[model samples]
Target: MEKKPSRSTEDRGISRARFLAGAAALGLAGAALPATGAQAAADTRTGRPGRGLTRRGVVYTVGAGETPGTAWDPARMRADIRAVRRDLHADTVDVTGDGVERLTATAAEAAERGLHVWLQPTLGDAPQREILEHLAECGRFAERLRRHGASVELSVGCEFWLFVPGIVPGETAQERIENLQTGTADPEQVQRRLTAFTARAAAVGRSVFDGRLSYAAAQDDEVDWTLFDVVGIDYYSYHQDPADYVRELRRYLRWGKPLAITEFGTCTYAGAPQAGGMGWSVVDYDKDPPEIKGGLVRSEHTQAAYLTDLLAVFESMGLYAAMAFEFLTADAPHLADDPLHDLDMASYAITKPVRDRPGDPASPWHWEPKEAFHALSRRYARAAC
Candidate 1:
């Protein structure tokens, strides 16, 4: 993706900054509530929780799956971390990728920049033993960071039933999801398997990383909250109403843990808020160069509005943290030529990744911030102030 200068917040004219500032102030002024058992232990280790969504963050995937094109260049990785802190006013970052080395390097970069790190090593579809080993290795590295006074947490795994084999009947994630949807995968059995796996993962994490333990659960994942310090959910707003979010989120509070929305954001297109996490399905990969299915309109404002509105909901709900789904998606570059070929429309990233000209040897692929970037910049900057 070709890098470009970002537009200023003043130029974007986003109005949510003041709203966010006021909301944060109100939250801080509210009477302090008694800490839950999980929160109490966390407080003992890391001090009390702040007002609302104190860990403002974005999920930055350094490398995942087979996308070598998205691999992190050390210099570019540092630049992105700096932007998350300086430009977005984000105090936390959820660093996810495949390898231990890549994940550790990225987390260290964010920590060095004074941003809290959620070290999530995403080794999708690997053997259970391999995944456990991966988490243990990453946890050890995170322990080193914590000992050195860096604010860091280790997320053992994310949505393992879909990503990890043996839990479900199918070999691949798509197949497992399909089988589950078709009722071939028994829900009760799946829950039992997930709970058992989470217990083992938590044990491994606790043995190495003493900072904090979390797992990024799917919206419906019935995780055993007793295994974690912070209950993490990858929340996407399929419904627009705040009441809907409140109703759905109330269940998590029963666990008596500080809830963190580890992932939240929609693609850059009209009706993406309704599409939620599946908004990326609009692209037809069967084509030589994949194109959008059809008729979807590109609307940066829709993406911006959805994110800001959800941020308000998270803040009002007093979430411990809410990480926007992503900062950028290098594999899904923006193509200005045609609507059908514009892959950025399906990305949740605040920035539109653009590749260099076809034959330019000196031009490196880079990114330019979208309207959502400016909107979030305003809200997060004001909230921090």
Candidate 2:
């Protein structure tokens, strides 16, 4: 079957610095209730969890984590962490981006909030020197957080074959995906290259960051589990089958190391769980001013159920931690009747993005919490109880 060309993520001309400067004060304050088993996992005094490394987490991404030109809003980033901590009741947040400065700034913000930080600095197919440079800065971020008695972990990178150059014979992630599917890329060679670099990163990271360390691995990658403290996977459910999903998860148990889900979530569209991560491309771009191609209904309920079902698996399986794919997916503001163009439609964020409304004085972007937000909060509260 011929795969149709994908409708690329529409670039809404939001400048990075413009958004950064403009989006600083977008948070509504609220006190967070403690999370379940968080105290048991970290020290009560410093609020530094992860002596045992258990976590309830969400990936606080800026610009989908992979989109080029993604920048961070220091104030909004801090506020999002607070929202994740307070709103979601999640104890940890995986701050992901390819920008080293952005990642370090995020770690500082997370530290100030007394929240556990997973600094996942992405490597965007750069050279060895650049990769090492990013790793060194990440080490500094981790060390600084530790000095302040904050819990921090450095995920060297995620899914190297897709992100790093020279590991696979592709110029772009999409090309690599196609190469893998078409049997043009050698899987064994890719694994070897990825493993070699990962080992090097672990050594560099350990030299400075005397805290926990792991990588956000894709499940299919043949990695050496012995090198790290925790085994992380970007596991998403296509709802292939609940039984089969659990069976695949059980396969990780053979490694005997702790398991962490680094990413997972569905789009807000109806029947999204079945579509999985690709649920966002609801447009056929062959036509000028691409038209909405999906026939599915818009269903926040489907997204909520998808989240709960996966969390249920993690809870029953005694996995280390599961970070939802994200806290904020896109910075695009909502426009009425333009549902297809609304960036939040493709986002896994639990908050629906809205423009400035009357009576809300903090900022231009207003985030309306979704059902998953409340569900996660309640679940975390119950677990903590």
Candidate 3:
């Protein structure tokens, strides 16, 4: 990865003390605080305490194969959850799944093991109708889980910003409408859809039982704020200075809702070339090799450093929740099976290699805890107690 000169060192005479003083004057707390009105409303909707919710919960990025009785044996899955709970001293685990049944069952299992569960389901490339149907399905699923006496703390559409019509990689508003046959769809359409979805969920809660539902969105866009009870942002370690990334988060706080760092991890693929002729050569940050045709690939040590710095900022922010990007991945074959995988893909596998050769296993990419992980775990354990 081409090293951008660290912002921590500007040629200007300003020192770290001055910067800290400025940040303190800004009234930015990296961790929890008294709930604002919007945050209280969101907490009511989500069935979580608005204040003191930042027990520094663990966000486990679960894959399809790692579920109970699947790629991981039931015993192993339970044991892993137990181990994570013990290690992090955390009681909450966020899980992603395909549908309501799978997610509800997973949540129930975790709840049985004394863990609060958050269900995350990706609203795939389905059109508007299908998407609404899926939301209704989620409502029904939440009802069923409640009937079964399972306590699912939250139900959020995973990567929801990816599915918003006008947004996303390709497809314009006109194209999205033609595809949906729905009326002219814009950001308003996206917001309306989300509002209706959440409204229906709240209605279902009133009719049946109450459950929390929100959407997890990438922190990239300003318009995403209008859609949810609680705001969710995926904070990554792609930036040079983690503090800069946290500063960007202040804009989202304007929404006045409780915020969650729903997905956070240091990318291990820094040396990969920029995609689609973006015109950046990928170089290994560790080696600083001349730009090969590929773009910059991040090193494992850089990844750990990024996480540590970012987590410190998060700790100072007093946000509602911050979850690590992932826990583990299937073996390399499984990783290869993911079509999204490419040279530049950001994989959080703490156990994978950038190249076939033996890379830095001690790097943040390895499964073992690094200094950053220990620091975060200690912080979380302290906060939880």
User: Which candidate has the highest lDDT of all?
Assistant: 1
Report the candidate with higher TM-score, 1 versus 3: 1
lDDT of 2 by residue, 237-313 (tens): 45433444555676777988889988877777777676554554564446554444655456678788788767766
Ranking the candidates on TM-score from highest down gives 1, 2, 3
Q: What is the overall TM-score of model 3 with all chains considered together?
A: 0.58
Q: Each candidate: what lDDT?
A: 0.74, 0.64, 0.46
Worst lDDT window (10 residues) for model 3?
A: 272-281
* Candidate 1: residue 241 lDDT (0-100): 40
- Please give, for residues 305-368, the per-residue lDDT of candidate 3 as tens digits: 5555555556556677777655544322112333222322334433342323222222222134
Ordered list by lDDT, greatest first: 1, 2, 3
Instruction: Give the root-mean-square deviation of each candidate in angstroms.
Output: 10.9, 9.9, 12.9
Model 3 RMSD in angstroms: 12.9
Q: Which should have the higher TM-score, number 2 or number 3?
A: 2
**Higher-ranked by TM-score: 1 or 2:** 1
Worst 10 residues of 2 by lDDT: 21-30
